[model samples]
Target: MVNVYVLVTSVSPLTSFLHDISVVMTIQHPRGQPVKLRDFLLQHLDPAASHQALRQVKQVISKVLQAAAASTNKKLRTISRCVLCFQLLTFTLLFSSSVTPVVVQVDTQLNVSGLSNDAFDQQITKDLILEDTLHFLLPPLSHLSSHTHLSSEREGSQYGGCTGTLGISLSEDEFLLLLHFQLLMKTSSAFQPLYPSVSSSSSLPRSLSDLPDLLTQIEGFYKLKTNRSCRTDEPPRQQPALSSSQDEGLCVDPHLRQIYTDPPLILTPPFHPLVKEYRTEVTFDTMTVRIRPEPVSSACRIHLDEHRGPRMANYPVGLGNSKISILVMDGSHPEPVIMSIYTVHVYRESRPSLPMFGYHVMCSFVQDCSLLVQPGRPCGLQPHSGSQSQRNACSSGHVSGRWVVPCLSCSDNRTCDWREVSWQPDGCYHPIVDHPLLQDCMKDRKLLFIGDSTNRGMMYFLMERVNSTLEDWGKAHDTLVYRNLNRGRTLVSYSYYPQFWLEKKQRPTFRQALQQLLNRSQPLVNSNQTVLVVGGVQWLNTNHLRTVSEVLDSESLSNILVVVKSLGMGFHLPVDGIRSLSLTEIQDLYRENDDIVTTAKHHGYEVIDTFSITMGRYKEFLQGRCACHFHEVTQLYLSANEALPVVRAAGLTADVLLCFLRWRSFGPQNLPVTERPPQTRTEQRELYIHSAANQPCQTRSRTRGLNPQPIVLEDQ
Candidate 1:
């Protein structure tokens, strides 16, 4: 008998020979049974070989067996171990050759380290530093294919060997093979489908029937088997399957269709067929997902599985949470036909909290069709941290101030009071003194005043004061040169020539024409020729009064400096009838004029508050129709009296004689006589006739002539 037992331990000299014998045994025993060493040898030998040769081997085996039978139990145990080792080797070879190939690649540095025997030791440390240096120079993911190897082992095997196991031991090459295999798998796994490389020989079927039966089967799978069971806490019944037509319209996995239909859940396996293979499959309890199609044609429609029921329907297209549908028509065809259907998954939005008062919010779509909320009109909100809490007062609809009183019937005592008066001395009316310009003005200058009739009043008053102080010293002129330059109104010009000379003691020559009087007149007078008088007073009474500042500041008077007084002061009173106003009404009118003066002063222009001045001297003058009848005499007298304190406080000397003459000629004057006789019948009758006729009587003709008397006044 050919002895099958052979001592073939890893340390034995015959180990290599025994391995070769094992390979031969695997080849001989196709049924995976253990083969005897003699049978393995016989398969390789020719049939013609002598039986003596076989007998010789049998004799040798018999001798060895006899010795093994006689040997100690320890020796026998060694023989059994060798036999088991040989058997194990045979089984390993058979199993290894039958296995599927497993290839793994080490692509990244991290993966390369895994292939190393002791990854955390010297090899990885060196590799890591090398990777860092080369990282910048490395190509991107799309490029580069590294060296790779193929290694294969049986599905279940303890030992495997290469074809040649001479110089290289199996253990020595195992790690290297695994590393090379890892690289092969990695590179192959990264292979992407070359879509452009594919020929377009396959076209879409002309009709639904022409499509492969597999397509209908896939549609059926989506429609019938896609839905999954809801939680046990919910209803037990299954959701209805979508119709075949509906299934054909959507491209989705049968198992995932139900999950996608319910509450926009993030799919563990994403909807894309190619990506689905790479993702981990899991059931998430809660997730937010947006589903939309690529190359979204107009035939796109969005349907909600919950609200619109199981049946799919066209959704109204608009911007909102509502379902949307877009219809695509083929313009090339005489009649448009539906080629394909698409479903867009609209993104759901969470409701935002209401904005606080004074806060505004705006919602708009971004360029990428995403909803965006932005802060809009800000009320009390500032750019600081505290602005978030602030609310706009105007938006809150609350009033904080006192109520304004409208025009109302006045109480008997309160009729004259538009506003409460201050018993304290009025600060608005005060003596003017210590002006820097006054000293220069006092050095004998010609001042001309030119404007409307109201300006004539101001001119007369200024002339009176200067002339009265410097009777022989200054020459004052109020030449009645009224010319109508614009429309029907007259422009009055007043010029003054003083006698004192700063450089020479002689009087300067005077110019006659209004223009020459203004521009060429030499200073017989002070070098200062500027006039401090009012003009455009009548402009205040007209509608143009509102724009008085604009007119006075116009280019025509750009070279001159003017001091205006009570431009809007005079009020028109009704001459006739039942609408006659009382003293209180007249006072209210005066208050309105004061408001105008206050406005002018607020704008930084110099405005003389003539309200107090005129109110003091002419109480009855405020009552009615006094402005039209006011001649130069009354105007000059009032102005002189009013302006006296101003001029004195300003410390300017007055020409008293000239002042008297100017005042005397201002109006037909019974003129401020201290004593008067009781009226006779004829005198009383004349007054009655004059009053009734409302006309100036010839009896006042004597007063019209210019008075030449030099009057002296006592200081009171």
Candidate 2:
């Protein structure tokens, strides 16, 4: 009952042609299921399938090759080459084998459209015919009972003892099958277009051009659902408190649900996670009011209006709450003018609320009548801190012609006057000003005052103050030559160069003066030995001023008072003076002054604001005169004496003396008692030098020449 059948199916006409080629080969097999030729040959012939299978395989291979020619992947091409080589080898082995005989027949016509050469097709056709002839004459053999027989025979042969049974070798078939299977696998791996679910009606596209319409519709639906859920799940917001006034009532009605839903309201979250609350109580002359929710937050804005001519507004009461306190005073009397207070709280998105808290009280007297309350002045806003027990002593009472009543404590309390109360809190106080460098200078160095008569006045005032404290200190002296007066240690020196112009009068330039001074005293003025204070020219009209810039251009004025003033002083003449002058003159004066200040700064000089200091102190005395006369000088000296304490406090310590000549008396009684100046020239000059003289100036060699020093006598 040896029966065999080969069934083949084809999707294209190419597969049918390949099947026709396979029918030309003849094979015999005992098969319940189809018998493979490889198994039959292993039992009879030494090799696997007969060569006739190669012809049919070639036909099948042609179709696969045609498919592979269309493929872009290099791996697919490699697979086709490997499959063709295996088929050729199988045919050679089958033709050499003397095992099972087989018939060859064509299964289908080959489709080689994708193949590049016709020579390959002709070679396959010749090979297939030759393999069929050998397969038909091969002898049949029985299956061996012992596995050793098959192993020994296979060891002597090159076919590796693999059986070509069941009409075809399973391994060989598997190789061919895998090749085609791989093509199927690759084809399956490609991306394919997806179709929308039929159940969705909204998936329809709006227009052929609107490719994303479906996605947009889905997203819109999702957003709508999310927003609705958010709205429904949110907690109701608590409303702020309102006054009992009918006008301030809420406008929402019971039947207004549709109105509420028509347009949803959006609210911003609080800036910080934690909620802050505060309370503030305000007291006017005759009224006291407390605002709700203190520390006004951005969520609430408060507006205040006063009936009086002057406008008033509510200020934040605390650090983080949305509350503001308002107090209105009665402005009817000349006593303390009070104003009417109206308070409104505006929510970020809602109408303003009425006054949450308020009250009226009558007061005996009003306080803080001015628009701008002066610092350190008494006002009712000050808290009573004299004693905890005395806080309740004051009582409120009604006064005639006053409608509102004041708090009992605020009305009768004398401490309620804000001007009398100090603004310093219970434990807080102003810091004392201290700089290490200033302290060191005051304690260790001798400062030189080296300007004009004004500088002399500053020196005198400083010296007087110092001498008053340290009785052993000597008085200041003025002379044309520099003199060191101390006998042993340098106590202090006061020298004067009294030329109306420190530089040559004809040249009138800072460069010339700096050069002359440096040439004469560069060693003394250098950083190590001295600190100089020099400024003068308040007396020079616009016509005679020599700016520091002109001087620096001519000579180096490094480390000098002239350089300091030129750099640091920001002084300009009155606007009226500049306007009155011609443009050319104005430009020249401006440029010269600017250059002087700049040069002074370049030299690292500390430009003391002498002009401002002098102007401010003796503004009245110098009101009408370009130069200070004897009387004015005397007044200046007196004024400097009075200002000595302030100067010391300012930390100016210098040794150089200042001198001013005037006809007024050095005695206190010389000037009118009522109109007496604040300081005299001698006193001011002495104070200035003493303040600067931390150490006394040592006496140096006196000049032994015809020009003798003028003797300076102390006032008895």
Candidate 3:
């Protein structure tokens, strides 16, 4: 009777005592013909290279027919006729219902692919993979091997009350001798301590300090026995399991949108007796994910970034939803531990050209982080080109525009007003230029300011617009200098780099401080009133713009005017007093800040482009102390609307207040400017926010209200 049809589909009633094993196997077929045990085990078994040893010999014949159906002498013993080898096999079952039905023979003439042509060259000397031999046909039900702790009314009436059928009838050569006795009960390490609760719950502990808490308590005991719920005949009642650090980890790549994970090597079972059986172990080298924030019905104005590469996390077009985690740890263990954890979950979707302004500013001189044209404008409507393939093609031209607030300023009754909302960068009408036409276009300009503290907040915003105040400025990184002697002594200086073009021994590098400020002839004055800005957010390279193209082809430093800033947007929140910054070092600081803004615009310099106006204003930074700076009421209305300079009450800083109205686009048009076009002309261009009494501020409320508090950095 060799018609072996054991069709077990979705079988799990904890293998309902594998329907009392009525053994009857006999097979000889080397042409005795009549074969059809699924067409002779599909012409000699190879379910893509051995279906994990035919599913562990159907789990050792369902634990030897559940030990003879939990025997009271239900009997079945004597299973020892072995010599199998697809790569070493042996067998035995020793059952007991008085040992009579033992007819188990299998001969099908040695090899027609029934393995042993050196089993695929010993499965490539056991490096094995078809997902490492289907990891023993899906083992991780928290490493399954239950020791009959069956109550909850007998495993909920044996997994939802009875569903029958187990008629055993083996033949395709005794199903290849029951897959070589399930690969000798999965590679017998002396039949694994004769099942001491599956050798202590599938053993591993050679102490890597309790292997991540025993692989998180065998993954929360196989997720509490597969989240139990078997209520068909209603006996369901056992819950309590959880703790392995409450176990929420492992969710990996749910259709990825930059939620990475890579330090993984957790293997063990190719016949695991711990250590060399399918071995694997990188333990961990470095992985760190944190994220956190998720309470949203709107207000967390999202902005994540975490990257270490292979896209670990970014989420910028804001709205909300977060939860990162990842961790991993091991640091070659001198006390580093944390072995594994993973959870990802992010979500964004808001868009209509997302800006709802929290804050954004990078303008060291708006030098094209793409699209801002206007200077002899003809690269065919500037399809954004500082070249290197159109520099991020208009990188969201600084949040396209909108955020207004306008008339509202009380003191004692509380509307104190942080210059009440005002960013306008979509198109470009930006008129308002007060403070004596930017202190008469910095009269005889020198403006140096080296790097960090966002280029000394554009030299304390053009020394509070040409000396209306900051006579000294001091946050101590040194070099200071502010001049303005009633506005034309105009000087400015600022040095403080705090290590930008990093070489650092006692400091020097930015090509040795631009060769000591071009061998100082007292403040780089070749004339055409010296304008040397230099930029920040610290790291910059094309060898610092080839030392600002050898100080702009020096004929004794050719009448100065250098610029190059470009790198804004850095909030990176994982919250707890803010200052974070890791989307893998903000993608290696935007590929070397867009390759040093395309080699500082092929060596000519002058490029503020506050990274497309603070790259969608990184959820409006300024949460206090320095969540990457911006609010002195959005840097006094981005320096009174990009350099027309008027608004006053100052405090937080870095959007380079449009690099002081981009130093009136490199000085001397004799101020009073006008522009005016955007009403519906679209290709994008309308940055207008007026009112320091220059009037025009009325688009109220697209929602704003953040108050986290801590920004006092003052010294500019």
Candidate 2's residue-wise lDDT over 253-305, tens digit each? 11100001001212123211132222222222211122221111112222223
C-alpha local distance difference test of each model? 0.26, 0.26, 0.36
Stretches of candidate 3 off by over 4 Å are 1-177, 180-350, 354-402, 405-449, 452-496, 500-506, 509-515, 518-523, 526-528, 531-571, 574-616, 620-716
**Model 3, 580-693: lDDT tens per residue?**
666666546655666777777677655655544554334443322233444321222223344222212222222333323433443324333342223331212133222231
Per-model TM-score on C-alpha atoms: 0.21, 0.22, 0.27
Error of 3 at 345 (Å): 19
For model 1, the run of ten residues with the poorest summed lDDT: 395-404
Candidates ranked, most accurate by TM-score first:
3, 2, 1
Best by TM-score: 3
Between prediction 1 and prediction 3, the one with superior TM-score is 3
Judge candidate 1 against the unseen true structure and give its global Cα lDDT, from 0 to 1: 0.26
